[model samples]
Target: LTCERYPVRRLPFSVVSEEDLASFERIVPGRVVTDPEELEASNVDWLRTMRGCSKVLLKPRTTEEVSCILRYCHGRNLAVNPQGGNTGLVGGSVPVFDEVILSTALMNQVISFHSVSGTLVCQAGCVLEELSRYVEERGFVVPLDLGAKGSCHIGGNLATNAGGLRLLRYGSLRGTVLGLEAVLADGTVLNCLTSLRKDNTGYDLKQLFIGSEGTLGVITAVSILCPPKPGAVNVAFLGCPGFAEVLQTFSACKGMLGEILSAFEFMDAECMRLVQHHLLLACPVQESPFYVLVETSGSRAEHDAEKLGGFLDQALGSGLVTDGTLATDQRKVKMLWALRERITEALSRDGHVYKYDVSLPLDRLYDLVTDLRARLRPPAKHVVGYGHLGDGNLHLNVTAEAFSAPLLGDLEPYVYEWTAGQRGSVSAEHGVGFRKRGALGYSKPPEALQLMQQLKTLLDPKGILNPYKTLPVQA
Candidate 1:
């Protein structure tokens, strides 16, 4: 039924017969999971939009184990889905139908950490937050931070090229991840996991798998450059009279807070209302048309505080911020952050949620949410907008009592068309999983998509790796 709902047809891949399970067991003994109950979570995605009937789930702990499983699957022309944390918004993390699920749950291990260089080498299955804590304890910090950090794995984050809260400061993982270890589709081990910050080789081959969404290879381990942990951090929750004022405030932040500004995020009142209604989390600032969360991280507490204090004072004095609150301590900072980070949870509690993560010019970012609010009229419970304002990414969400076809009909190509009109990306951080493959052209040109297809064929000639996903369906 789930397969019928989508457009993709089953590829000419082998079904997991008992013989295949036996072969997989030999590669990772005691780890071949076939229990339907155990396979349930892996089959469903984070947003519950897609489901797959994967009959077999393989847990491989080492590079050799992964290489063996992939080699066998590739040789037999069996479809495979590589899963990590299963917290992706797009429908890419699960099998579309009966593809085998290759999980990285057992591959978690810290390979090495160099304190002086702030470099960390770790297995792909290592949880992002755990690595954050590990590095923080060693006087460094993971350059990336996201809401699902507690559960999302480092490999998944890199697989999706996740751009989270810290991108405004440390930049995307493409810049921070020095090297990686990946297994090619046909079982060749490609190890480029070097801890160097600067290396100009013939070609940066590891970059291919960074955001390929597992269609090219399975990322086994990564070597990344970590910045030293900031000694001082500050959070400010502010309310703005309108979107224009929000823009002015962000301009002020980039000018005054420049180097220390770690993140600049914005949300509409609809988002705040849902956070209060479902999660019962009270809004920290007085009600306003728009809200912004500005975070600053620096080396010296006194210096950062003085800089933040002046920034806030100027924002208020210029009426850039209608009202605001600042928190310097850790607990209060997290509580305020919960206002932004817990939005996905609140949206979930509302009901079935249709999420759109897009990149647009800051001036035009909120326009789509506004456009949909007018067009959808009713039935759509909420048309909420919020996201990393600093990076020009917006998380547009629409919730209803349940999934509705008419509502979807009104949203689909219209949203994609609007994004194309602005020359914006249909997906910013979330990779083009199954559901979004059709819209990949809105962001990437035909030539770019062609090149991507050529690369996919070259790296995964069998078309057995993550089949029916990532690549655009028609082209």
Candidate 2:
């Protein structure tokens, strides 16, 4: 049924026979899940747009167990889907067909942490929020923060190279992650998990798997550099009269706040309405065309507060911000953040959401959403835009009563072409999973795609690891 909605011919790979299940049981005894009821959740993605019929789910606790399982699967010529958290917006986390689901759920462990250096080495399956708590207790904070931090695994985050709220201050996972250990297609363990920040010995092999989306290998362990937890943190929720004013406010924010600025996120009025209507969230500021959430983190509370207050005064004085509310306490900070972070959940509740994550020039970030709202008049229930403005990532979401092929037809090539025209990324934070594999050409050239295919082939000769993901199928 899923295949009917998103058609793909199943590749020739061995199906799971009784002997195969028996071998998997020996590899990860008592962890091989085959029951359909239990597999239901694992087979579906977080967005619920993609579904798979994977018969076997393998949960391994250690890299050795994962290596052994991949080794066995490689020999059997069976397709293996390496999954983590299963919170991927793309269909990459879920098996497209009957591929054996190799999950890192049971590999949750903190391998090591250096308090002085603030380097954290942890198992791939450790939840992001728990890791954040663990690091915060030691006076450090994880470089990234996502809406699904409570459930999304560190491995999954690395696999997708997730750029979240704190990316503005901390940079991407590719920069924060010092090293990692991954299990290759043939079960060879590539152990580059070093805590050292500067290592230019040779080819940075770990970078290959950071955003490869599991098509290259399964990331087992990671060593990341966490920044020291800020002594003072503040959140400002402001309403902007228009998109231009929002841009002006961000410019002023960066200028005034300087290094203390941690994040700059924006959402249209439509997104705020959806959040209020569906999630029962209250608007902290007066209603306006656009809203911006600015965050500050610094070592000195008084100095940080002064800088933030100055930035706010400048924004309000310049007519960049219509109305605003600043929060110094943790409760208010969290409340302000919830309005931006929960936009995805609110949009989902409204109707079937067609989500697109793109990176455009800052000035043209919100243009696509406005264009779509005008284009899809009758079918589209709502077209909203929201995302990290500092990083130039736009989350354009369109909702309809339900999924319709005609509606999708109106969005596709048009959206991709518009992104390509601006020389922007079609998939900014989210990797090119099964759903966006075909659109890879929009972002990458043919030669790049060819080289990507070559890398996939060299790393996974049999194409047994996460087939139908990341790279586009060559015609």
Candidate 3:
């Protein structure tokens, strides 16, 4: 396999032989998948842009099984790719080479839940939406949400330290994730899955795996803090004259709603047009240069509604907003959110997508997008900007009739250079997977990169766990 040439520094290495296959079957039995047809789905990413050359896919149901497999693979100096829902944007969830594919799909199980404390513990492969449903039934929320909720797994979210729509209110996973249980590359299970809110221990070791992108270990289970579901929810879709008004409206809403404000998302006219044209979703507001989707959740419906209404009225009267629509019913609220959440899906349907999840100063975000759009106007079919505005993260995507070298070249260093110039992050939410490894230099210092390499060397040593990912090649 091509992965074998990647130079994993360890011992007992060789191609998979009959003896290895027999040993693997002894552990997983029927779950050891070698059929090309079955392995086909596991080798490709969600975007169908990258493909791996793996010949075997192993689905382990328990942490013990995973540990056992890793022990054997580590002993034999074999590379392993840990996969969750395969919905990662940065090609982190899929294999980069022909390493063994270790999928957590069959490990889905809810271990425990504390109603009073609002904490839930579950296996790594449980779907995000399923976890949300389980907790929502008890008047609690998962404290995290994303467009890929239906397919993305909690372990995957933790692996990437996923920040989603509710981040403005609930904060990042770094705060909400209480503890984690991970299986290290050497088959050692680091069990720290506690539900305690505060623990000022020496190292906070579990954090190493949170955004490590499976390089350090495979996340087996997670214990996360859930928030109580608000009794009242209000959503408003507002049209703005330009990006400046979007920022102004955000500041105004933040002051007006305070704690009740949960989300402040922004989308440009180009994105709305794509969503309407591709997804067939009708735009709720008049066509404008920009749109802001503001949501507030609180225990008191009357108070929350009054706050939202007052803010909208003031913004409109002050010319901060041009037109708006308020969604009071649950169905209407969902419909409004769909327009923002479904932008990714709509863009996928358009053409070959080059996605960038970057962070820039809130004031310079509009200028960045405008500058990039002007630069790529001819080579790129469409360039759209939208994302969690309140968090300063922008999902800048460019679509082309087909993937071309010129189109990609024009977007790189230029976009990354611009972000770096503004002291912004090249990757705000998405981890540095195979796709963004080369761009790490733009965001990380040389010393930091050296330390990351040293850590990867110490953890895996053999470079078996998700090789060629997160950290770039050290000179």
lDDT of each: 0.92, 0.93, 0.90
Mind giving the per-residue lDDT tens digits that candidate 2 earns over 1-475?
Answer: 2366766788899889999999998989999999999999999998888889999999999999999999999999999998888889978999998999999899999999999999999999999999999999999999999999989999999999999999999999889999999999999999999989899999998999999999999999999999999999998999999999988898898888999999999999999999999999999999999999999999998888888888888888888898899999999999999999999999889878898999999999988888988888657899999999999999999999889889999999999999999999999998889888989999999999999999999999999999888889668
The best candidate in terms of lDDT: 2
**Please, what is the TM-score per model?**
0.98, 0.99, 0.97
What's the ranking of the predictions by lDDT, best on top?
2, 1, 3
Query: Model 3, which residues run further than 4 Å from truth?
Result: 1-13
Rank list by TM-score: 2, 1, 3
Candidate 3 lDDT, tens digit per residue, 156-258? 9999989999999999999999999999999999999999999998899888999999999999999999999999999999999989889999999989999
Runs in model 1 deviating more than 4 A are none
Find the 10 residues in a row with the least total lDDT in model 1: 1-10
Could you tell me the TM-score of candidate 3? 0.97
lDDT of 3 at 53: 70
Q: Which pairs clash in the backbone of model 3?
A: none
Clash pairs, candidate 1, are none
